[model samples]
Each structure stands twice: as structure tokens, then as C-alpha cells.
Target: MTANNATPPAPPVPSDAVGEGLKAAFRFHPAGVAIITATTDRGPSGLTASSVSSVAIDPAAIMFSVTRATGSAGAILDADSFIVHLIDGEHAELAQNFAVSGAERFTEAQGWTMRETGEPYLPAARVALRCQTLHTVTVGSSVVVIAQVLEVIEGTRGEPVVYLDRAFHSVATA
Candidate 1:
């Protein structure tokens, strides 16, 4: 077959590819870690996310995805707004706590507080952005949320937490 008319080889079937292989492929890429938090009737809820990204600067918007049907989904979906926190190396325990299937994410001992709208916020985050959900699209097992940053809260500055090679590392300031 001529190059222009040649049919491309069929894409590899996903089922034929091992899940671990896909995961391992992405393991080489490093991503900044953050925690997404919201408050619902049940209580404060959160999850650790490495998929957070700034979608736009003029509008000051950000986007992140969360697994559908998860505990934090309802809180984030029902609320008009939520908080995204940039975690540092020292907050690995906090990240792991929120990463679990069912864990007490926000305890009184952690000193979490609520905004005027009642959404919970973590005070110790390296940086916090209060965002208003603008749009959402469901893709596969995840819901991608795009939000406009309504407020920015600066916190303790230092090394940032990053996830890579299935482990967490601190970005060096120097």
C-alpha cells in the first residue's frame, strides 16, 4: 500500500495491554500534588490529586479530575465552590490520609475551618485556592471539574510535594 493510502496498524487493544504497563509508563512523569476539599451534609471530604492543572490564566481557572462515585464526589458536585490546596513534603501523611478509600479526612484535631459558604479549608496548605465550579465533563471513571479561582490564600512557603515513580519527593528550592 502507498504511504498516503496505507491503513495505519490497528491501535493496540486496551484489554490486550496490561494495566500495570500503563501505570508504569506514567510513573516516569512527575506531578505536583494537591488536595481537593469540599463540605457536604455528611461532613468535610477530600482527596489527594496529582492531576491538578491551570487551565487558563486570564480567567484564572484550574482543572482536576476525581474518580466518579467516590465519597468526595457528592460534596464537590453539590457545593458551588471548593478548595484546592498545594501540599508540601511535610504533608505526605495528610495526603495519604485523604488518598484512602474511607478515612477521617477532616478531624477537629487538624483544625480545619469553614468558609463563609461553609466549605472546609485546610489552613496549613502551602497555597490554597478557593474556586467556583464552572464546568464538568465525565470521562470514563472520572469527572473532570473546571473551576474559576475566586480567591487565593498564601501559606507557608517551602519545598513542594511531587509524585513520581510511585513515590513522593520534595522539590528543592535551591
Candidate 2:
């Protein structure tokens, strides 16, 4: 068949199926865990994120995606700056608290504090990256945020946590 007359390729797989397949595949893939927090006009907001990744080093940049532009995600998007807490297994409960909608967050018992710049900070994190929002891109149902890491706050070190098979797991030195 000629270029313009060539038969069309088979229909793409339905998004629902593709999504399920993607989730299934990722269930076996381990990802480091982080909790992103920010201060908004209303109050403090944050969420657990497994999508955080380093984008650059010299300039110190990081990228993460929020599935919805509402709740803590919305607050983070609107904030001028935020903190990405690199948490360890000891903070798994805190991670779950942030991940769940309407869960009590920033509670005094959670060891949350406000940074001088006003961003919510977690002193218990293995490391906290204070970042200023640099750019954002909307892709499908997710908003991808790229931020410039302004400062790195070191905290207690322990076994790093990872998300895999819908659960938090600790990684120990081999």
C-alpha cells in the first residue's frame, strides 16, 4: 500500500487496560519514598510521593508528579516553595498519614515544623530538600513539578524505605 493509503495500525489498547498493566508492572519495581510538604494560605499540606527523582546535580534540581491538582497536591502546586523529605522506614507511618486523604498531618506528634522560609519541614526525615518551584507541566491526569533545591537538611539516618508491591519496605546494607 502507498504511504497515504496504507492500512491504519491496530487500535491502541484501552486506557483502563493500559493503566492496569502499568500498575502491575510497577508493582515489581521498587521506588524510593519521599514526602513532599508545603505551607499554603489555608494551612500545611503534604503527600507521600514515590515519583520523586533527581533531575540535575550542579544546579540541584528534582522532579515529581502529583496525580491530582487538589488537596495537598493543589496546595503544593500553588506554594512558592516546598520541602521534599527523604524518609526512611521509621517514617513509614508518617508517609501513610500523608498519603491518605483527610488524615491528620503536621500534628505535633508527627515531628513537623515550619522552616524559616515557611515551608513545612520534617526533622525526622533522612534528608530534606527545601526547594523552590521552578516549572510545572501538565501531562494527562498528573502535573509534573520541577524544582530547584535551595538547601539540603540532613536528619537521622537509617534504613532507606522503598515502595514496592503496594507496601513500604526497608533496604539494608548488603
Give the per-residue lDDT of model 2 (tens digit) for 1-174.
Answer: 234546788778578889899889989999999999998898888899999999999789999999875688999998988999999999998899888877888987889888999988888789999998888888788999999999999999988889998898877779
Give the lDDT of residue 82 in candidate 2: 92
Output the number of the TM-score-best candidate.
2
lDDT of each: 0.82, 0.89
- Model 1, position 34: C-alpha lDDT score: 88
Number of colliding residue pairs in model 1: 0
Model 1 is weakest, by summed lDDT over 10 consecutive residues, at: 1-10
- In TM-score terms, candidate 2 sits at 0.89
Error of 1 at 158 (Å): 2.6
**For every candidate, C-alpha RMSD to the true structure in Å:** 4.8, 4.7
Worst 10 residues of 2 by lDDT: 1-10
lDDT (10s digit) by residue, model 1, range 1-174:
234546788768677367778777889899999888888778777888899999998899999888887877768877777899988887777788888876666776765777786777778778899999999888778898899999999978757778998789877777
